[model samples]
Each structure stands twice: as structure tokens, then as C-alpha cells.
Target: MGDEAGTANQGAPNAGVSKSVSVRELVNRLKLEVIVGEEALDRPIRRSKVHRPGLEFAGYYDFFPIEHVQVLGKKEITYLHKLTHQERDERIGNVVKYHPPCFVVTWNQDGLEYLTAHCRKEGIPLLRTPQTTTEFMMLADGYLMKQLAPEIQVHGVCVTVAGTGILLRGRSGIGKSETALALIRRGHRLVADDAVVLKKVNPQVLLGTHNGTTREFLALRSVGLMNVVRVYGRGAFQDETRIVLDIELVPWKENELYNDLQLEPQTSEYMGVRVPCIQIPLQPGRDVAALIEAAAHNWYLQTQGYSAADEFMRRLQQQ
Candidate 1:
């Protein structure tokens, strides 16, 4: 699942995982469980598994809180045995406190067979794999992560442009296209226009970009949709949107303290979900396009825990 209330990059931890799940689902992801040692079911797993797994294998932990881990291969046996008996006792204690992850692991077939025997011998279900440890962990992680990751409608956008999710929004007449055109002129590629699609992919990730139907170019008020590639060449266009700061367009209002938008940006409830929103009011003669681009890049700084508005407000309070 995901953390219910956090930015897209922060990745909320709860999407759909409840207090419990069906064994069938768990087995589908974890594949097999190998239970070793007679005391395996009695307490936590005594040995610590490898310190770090391969990147490809990190997805297998369905956020189970890592209650216990089994180190079965002979390579790790000496290191595991090096632990004091009391340390072993504490490690295994996590098993008693948490079930399911209590006892399971094997090195070679000998270890596997031993573990399998206890699981079957004691009526505990065990899973076996012909693949090596590396392959096994990958399969396990892939399955578990899929089971735990949130479901979102993705618009396929490159999100490496700073951290904030930047959304450009405005009415058809409001120069959303002209602003985007000018932004691209200023070097920020267009995300999506005409029809911008969005989706929440991971726990904290909200992906927005141009849909396949409209990825090629943007339509402007002064002109029709121009081919960015034709003008700026390649790398000037994209097919996705990462919605961090929402750049809004409306005729200028002198009464409105436009930039008072938000410094320590907070979530705005959209539909039933909450998302970070920044409102940028647009007006004529203000170079709306350049401002939107600047707003996006500035949002990056703010999201990095640097709040210009907050610091200014604090100083004003002191004065």
C-alpha cells in the first residue's frame, strides 16, 4: 500500500495492505517458505540475512516490518554462529512477537531439506525453489511489491526535474498554451496540454504527462499547436506530468497577493485524495509562461525543505 498522506515522492506506505491477508495471496508473492530448526516456529529467526539485497530484489518486502530473516547458505553460517547465544535469543525473540516470519531459511539442499522437513513434519507449509538465492529474492520481491504497490492511472512523465510535481492548468482562453510555449522557450519542456491526464502510481508518486493523443505539441491562444520538435528540435517535448505545483491561470487581480500562494506547501483535497497544490495567478503583461517555469523550479527548492516564504514570514514576525 502507501502512506495515506504524503507527497508523491515520499511514497505513502499503505495502499491496500490490511492487518491480514489470505495465505494464498502471500504464497503467490513469496512463492515458498522454508522452515528450519526445531525452535524455528517457537521464536524469531536467529540469523540475520545478508545485510543488503540487490536493487532488483528490494521490492520483495511487502512492508512486513522485517520481523525476522533467515540466513541459510553455508557462506553465512560462520558469521551467524559468531553471534552470542543471548544475541541469538533476542533475534529469535522477534518471531515470538510476530508470527509467519518466525522460522524459515536454508543454505544448500541439505539446509533446504532440513527446513522442508520441519515445515512438513510439523505441519507448517514450506515453499521450495530450484533457482539460486538471487533469483529467488527477485521473484519474491517483484511479487510482493506488486501486491503492495498502489494502483494509479499513470500518464508516463519523466520526474527527474527536481522533486516537486508541477501541474500547469488554466482555461482554453487563458493562454495555457502560450504560457507553456513561453516556458518551453525558457527551457522547461511541456508536460501536457489540451488534455492532461494524471495518475497516482506509487504510494507518494503522482504521475502527470501528456497523453499519447496529445504528446506531440501544444496549442496556443495566439497560434495553433506548434511542433516543439520542429522548432526547438528534440528534447523539447515530453509525454508525462509530475504534479507537484499547480500553476494556475486567470486574468490578473491587483487585490490578490498572488505570490502569497504557499511557502510550506500543504496538501489540497482533490476528489477523495489529498495532494500538494500551489496556485499561481496569471495576468497579461506578466510573461505568464516564464513565470510558470520559474514557479516549477522554485517549487523544487521549497520541496527540498527550503521555504523562502516561510523564512520571510518568520522575519516579518520578528520585525
Candidate 2:
């Protein structure tokens, strides 16, 4: 039996997959200058939270998050300047002894002999950034969070119809790609064609993107694989979008009961995140693309506290 959400309880595939971003990746992506410890660029940054190490600099190390990337900003640098050389060396040593993934000095602050010495000795990567403390922290944290987020690859087509992100899921040769093509011709944007990578950005958000290699191509059963961007122009393709709905296309079965009225909500789970789902029965001469477009518009209305079903019921009662 299914749960109240109308989805069968199933284990999430690749839900517990461990993910990390290497210091080298961070440096290249963020354009950070490598000051020292180039040999340690392969160090893995598993945690998303970038540590400021303010307390550690003040000679307190209790409950320190040693696994995170340590960031030294303008405030921390100014604080170190007031301390004696010996005090600064001791405090910096105490923190670097843990051998955190890396150390980032923000705002291009100078006079880091003590910090660099310890980082070199411990073989911890020391990086420099021109952005301010808060700015760099936000960038690094966001990048790390996305890189380390739990992700699962789904065999489906993802598109944006009327600004709503929709994931079309069905078996092979079930017209998933064809419907997506139709939607694209109707001015909708295709995010991913064959394989959609869904990442759990947070508890309430699931972001979907295309598989890197196949992002620019779409496969149609009628025709062969075509480059969507080259054929349809760049406006019809999007790199990623927040998945708000899932549409499952199933073959029309004789004597099978289907929901005619979408009064109750249905959802499908991926990586512990539930997304609204609609199961559409496939039949001859059915305009599945039109149905999906309407569904996207209806979802937008529901978000604005307007339900067509409820309004219809009210009209019937008045009559």
C-alpha cells in the first residue's frame, strides 16, 4: 500500500553517496591564488560550512570544526596584527595542527608569514582571494554546498513549461522525448534530455540539471539524436532549473481506473524530497504536450492560492 502522499515507499538510490570538492577544484572555480602547499591541492573539502576560526585565533580551540575550510578575513587578520609575534605563531600553529582541508585568506590581506609557515609545514593548502570576507564566504559556501549535495541521476527529460520545472518520467519508447520536443516547440525550454541529475539543494528544494556530456543533445525515437541548441537555438535550452513537478506517462490499459479530477495532491519522492506528481495515461491521438502545458499553468495557480477544482465545487453548490 502506498502512503498518504500516494507514492510507494522505496529506498533512495545514491542517497548516501559521499561527495567532496577538492581544493584544486575550488581554486580553479573560484580563481583563487595558490599561496603555498600546492602539493596539497588534492585535499578533499567534505564540509560546506567555511570556518572563520575567530575563536581559534583567540587561543580557544574547544569544539572547533576542523573538517571545514578555514577562512581568514579582514577582521581575523586585524586581530592577529594586534597580537605579539609569538602569540600569533602559537595560535596559528594550534589551528593548523589539525590539518584542515585548506586555508583561504580573503581581501588579499598581507603579513601571513605565521599562517603560511604552519600551512606549509602541515602541507595544508593556503589560498588567497580578492573578494571581501563575506563575499568569498558566500561564494565558497554556495559552491561547496552544491558540490557536496546528495544527488541522483534520473532517466527522464526535464523541461520548463510556463516557468515551471517539470520532470517527465516513463519507460523507454514511451514518448517522453517526443512530448518534450513538442513542449519545446511551444516555446518551453528543455533542461535535460535523456538523463536528468537531481540534486537535493535543501529540505524543500530539488534542483535538476542535465548530464554534462549529453546536455546539448536530445534523442527522438522518430528521428535520430539532434543538438537542441543548434537546432532550436540557445533560447530553448536551460542548464538547470528547480524541479517542481513530475509527470509519469503510462500506457493506457483497458478497464484501468484513472483519476479524472485532480482534487487530492499526489507526490513522488527523490532523495527524501517529495515533488508533486501527475500520472498521465497515453492513448492514440492524445495531445500529451498540451496536457502538460495546462498542468504547468495549473500548478502556478495553485501556488497563488487559487484552485480550479475548489472553484468548480463552489459553483456546483450555488446551483
Candidate 3:
């Protein structure tokens, strides 16, 4: 989760201020400053490296402010030199071409007057830090500050058991837990909930899960909170999952435009990964557990080159 090798002893002042943010959001704030002290950039901003401020810590920053990048003064910035004009031009090109940075950062204490004037002219937010690069990175990583791809919860567990990953996604309060509980009861393992962290392990492989604890936990509205690990034992908690198939649960609607009762399951798209999805609409009295088992069974069949949806469509073609 974070770098805990050493702690920041008698740390310097902190520059962070508060603004409501997720880990993903914080990384975006830092990256906005294309020009960070090279030494600072070399380190990280995750939580592990950065310790809480004190004699052994740098103290706490409220949070990152609206101004994205935090700048370190030259006295504060060491091991970083002025970028060559050519390098500056190239970096600037990248910045303008892809994403506009909020401001410039530097390591020159003497250059503060110059930086101030330039920032004012450019109208970008500016920040100063004294804790140096290494500490900043440790802190950032510990905070879980990393950019995220678009996230969507698939309706079920994506297991690596057979190599084809499955994603289970459903609306809030739709008994996703209840269904997952049944799957686990049937010997299927648990993965993540509320949010799933996915990384591009490779082109064909993706790692998905809640940080080990998220899966072994469930939140139920009617009965209050329950413990998955205590109730189901350690077999229920999975370290991670491979993503392949995504199942989405939708509530059944009588509205003609809102309903799709076709036997064929529809496909949904996200972050360029296309997955076979089962659209199970919720009803007051429907067998959800049976439906999910059937979906997994259906997925297994698809792996073996048999598709119930295709067969249903083929029958219509013949008719």
C-alpha cells in the first residue's frame, strides 16, 4: 500500500490543503504541474513514502487545493537544474498537445521572485514545499494516489480459475452481495465490492480486486453489517481476480423503451475492453441465485464454443 522503509524525521513544513478528493483525483492534481523538481519527480507521491508530519513526520497537509501542482522552492529543490531550452520546448509541446499543466515548479530559492512574476503572468497556481522529493513520493503512494481508468462494477466475480475473468456489476442495493454470497456458498470465491482496483498487468491480462479486505466484507441494508471472512471462512477471500466476463443486473421495467426481454445477452463497453455481459433485470420474485449460476454455466459453455443466446437467435432465424 505504501513505502514504509523509513520515516520522515523532523520533517519540513507541509504545503497540502484540503479539497475533497479520491486517490485518483489527487494524482491528477499533482500531474498538472508538468515541471516538478527533477529530484522530487524521481520520487513518488503515494502514501507509503510520505509519513505524517512531526519530529519523525512532515506533519499533515489538509489536502491538495484547487491549484494542482505543488511547487518546491529552490532552497527546497536540489538535484534539479533548469531545463535546457530545447527540453523545455519539447516538454511544453507535450503539455500543450496532451494536457495543459496548471503551473511550473522549480528548485531555485533565489528564483522565487522570477517564478512569482512568471506564475502571475501565466495565471497558474503555484505551490512551495520544503520536505524534498523523496518524502513527497512516499506520502503520495501511501495515500493511494494513482490515476484511474474509467471504473464500472461488473455483476460477479472475475476468477482466474479457468483463465477467463468474469466481472459482476449491478446497481446499488440490488442484492449483488446476496447473489455473490450464494455464489460463494456454491464454492465460487469472492472478489471486490463498491469499487474494484484494476491494473493493466498485460495486454491480455488484468488484475482486479478490492484490497483483500473489501471482498471478505459485505454491507447489507435489511440485516445490518455481516462479516464474510468470519461467516464464510478464509476460502471466500480472494487476493485478486482476472477480468474477462462482465455481468450487469438491471431492474425490470414495464416501460417498453426501458425493457429488453430478448434471450440474447447484450454487450457493454468500457476502457476498450469488451466483455460478454448478462443483463439480468431485477423483479420482486425472480430466482437471482439460479440465474447467476446459469450465467457462469453459460460462460463456461461459451468457452467450450456453445452460446445459448446464439442458439436462441438461430432458432428465430430458422422460424
Candidate 4:
């Protein structure tokens, strides 16, 4: 399972903190074989970057980042093969002394006995992958970025309406899933229901997706569980999309005494990125689905520097 350390404490609506993943999780997710030091699987890989260790293995340890996962490719392994047994032992011993999170041998490890022995003795994890150097590095780096990325899980439904990712938040039994199902029937795509995992892959971009068995499924009140793909077809489900809008639904209240005119803009901050938020009060015959669709469309226009409300206000002021 993915790390839920960041999922437990979801602070005020949209605030989120950074996340971390253990070496054991990476090993299982990436399908890397544990060649030695299985006991050190609990090591925490603090850094997202993977080191090639070409220079380190070549007897140059200056500026080597031992906290990162080290990958040994064909070139690095070939270099070790060219060295005498004693030289190779000394070189590997030096690297093992640094105690990197783990060493991943890509493609094969036909001549890594010295390195493996030193790693096992020092209680350092040694992993191997059948993928080529480039392939393994690419996969590992991509997976690491996702696992190490700052994430926040929200109690909401994320759906794509008119190409805009909108997170619908509300209290329990507030029709969040119902609204999402309506949008999906209208040809929009559902990213997640019940629990939406938002990851800050980029500094300003937040991507929405679902974790575990919740993906591609929605739970309705009358209906127990329904698969979005089966009910609305395959086009109704999306793996992930950039979250751009946050819509909070509230039960209509009498004498709410709030601003009738939305003169002030509201935003929700998640993992340091701000997203535009709109609160819609739920009432009988409000056509919530259409309202959400319109909100998303308006937000999309706003991103392009166009605002209908602002334009209308400007014309009224001139009058």
C-alpha cells in the first residue's frame, strides 16, 4: 500500500504538508529484488533523486549523496569487473561504508559478489532489476517523484467538467457523489469519489487521483457501489487531471445573511498552491449539475484572463 502519513492529518480544508515513502515501499512498488540486507528495508529514502554512483564506484566519493538510492548500470558494473578482486572489494567497501539507502543493480549482477557481500555485512539493502539501466532509472525516478511528492487527501469528489478538474466538497450525505454521477452522465469524466488524493507534482500544479480500491468507482446512497466505467462507459473515468476549481456545497439556510453578490474572490491553498473556490448553497430544483458545469466553464475562462462577472460590473459602473 502507498504511504498514508500525509493522509491522516488533513488540516483546514485545503492545507497539506510534504509526504515521505520508505525504502521497503519503493522496493515492492518497483518490483526490485532484494539481493541482500533485507533487514534494512525500513530505511527512509529522504531524497527523490536516484544516483548513478559512476564516480563513487570509480573511487571518487566527493559530493556523493548516500541518502539517495544508488543505481549500478552496465558501465559501473563493467568498471568493477575490470578491477582486480582486491581493488573491487576495496571500492565496494568504501561505497558500503557510506551506507546509501540501497544499491540497485540494473540488468544483471554477474560480477557483484564483492559488492553484495559488503552490502549484506554492513546491513545495507542491495536490490536488482532486470530492466536496462535507462529503463530502470526512468521508472525509479518517476515512481520516486510521485511517492515523495507532497500529497493531501480530501473528502470530496473530483470530476472533469468541460475539461476543468473540479473538486466537489460537502458534508456526509450531501450528494457529492450524486452530483458527480450526473456530470459523468453528461459526458464529463470522474477522477475519484469519496476520497480524492491530490498531489503537488509541480510547485503550482495539483493533480487529483484516487488511491487503493476507490479508483473508477462511486458509492451512491440508494445504490451500494457502482463502477463509473461500466455505468457511463469508459470515457467517464479519468486516471487523473490537474485540479483547477474547488466547489463546496452547503445546505440552503434561511436568513444566512451572507454576501448576495460575490464581490470577493475565494481561494483554497493545498500544498502551497492556491485554487479558486466557489460555494454553492444546495436547494430544491437548483440544477446543481448544470451549476457546477457553468462554474467550471467560467473558471476555465478566468484562467485565460477573462471574467464575465468583472466585465458585467465594469459595464454597470460606466452606466
In terms of TM-score, the best-performing candidate is 2
The root-mean-square deviation over C-alpha atoms between each candidate and the true structure, in angstroms, is 11.0, 2.4, 15.4, 5.8
Cα displacement (Å) at residue 259, model 1: 7.4
Q: If scored against the real structure, what TM-score would every candidate get?
A: 0.48, 0.92, 0.46, 0.73
- Per-residue lDDT of model 1, residues 252-309, tens digit only: 6788674544455456432235565544566546766555556667766766898777
Best by lDDT: 2
lDDT (Cα, tens digit) per residue for candidate 4, span 145-229 = 7777777777889999988988888788999999998898899999999988888877888888997679899999988999988
- Residue 80, model 1, lDDT: 38
Model 2 ranges off by over 4 Å: 1-12, 15-17, 254-259
Error of 4 at 64 (Å): 3.5
lDDT of 2 by residue, 1-319 (tens): 1133223322245756678899999999999999999998999989998999999888788879999999999889999989998888888888888989999999999888887888888999999999999999999988998888888787889999988999888778999999999998999999998888888889999898986988878898758998888988998899899999888888999898776774467788877788898788899999999999999999999999999999988999999
Q: Ten-residue segment with the worst summed lDDT in candidate 3?
A: 1-10
lDDT minimum window of 10 residues, candidate 1: 47-56
lDDT, candidate 2, equals: 0.87
Stretches of candidate 4 exceeding 4 Å from the true structure: 1-25, 33-46, 58-63, 78-86, 107-110, 130-132, 211-217, 222-225, 233-235, 251-265, 281-283, 298-319
Query: In model 4, how large is the Cα lDDT of residue 169?
Result: 83
Candidates 3 and 4: which is better by lDDT? 4
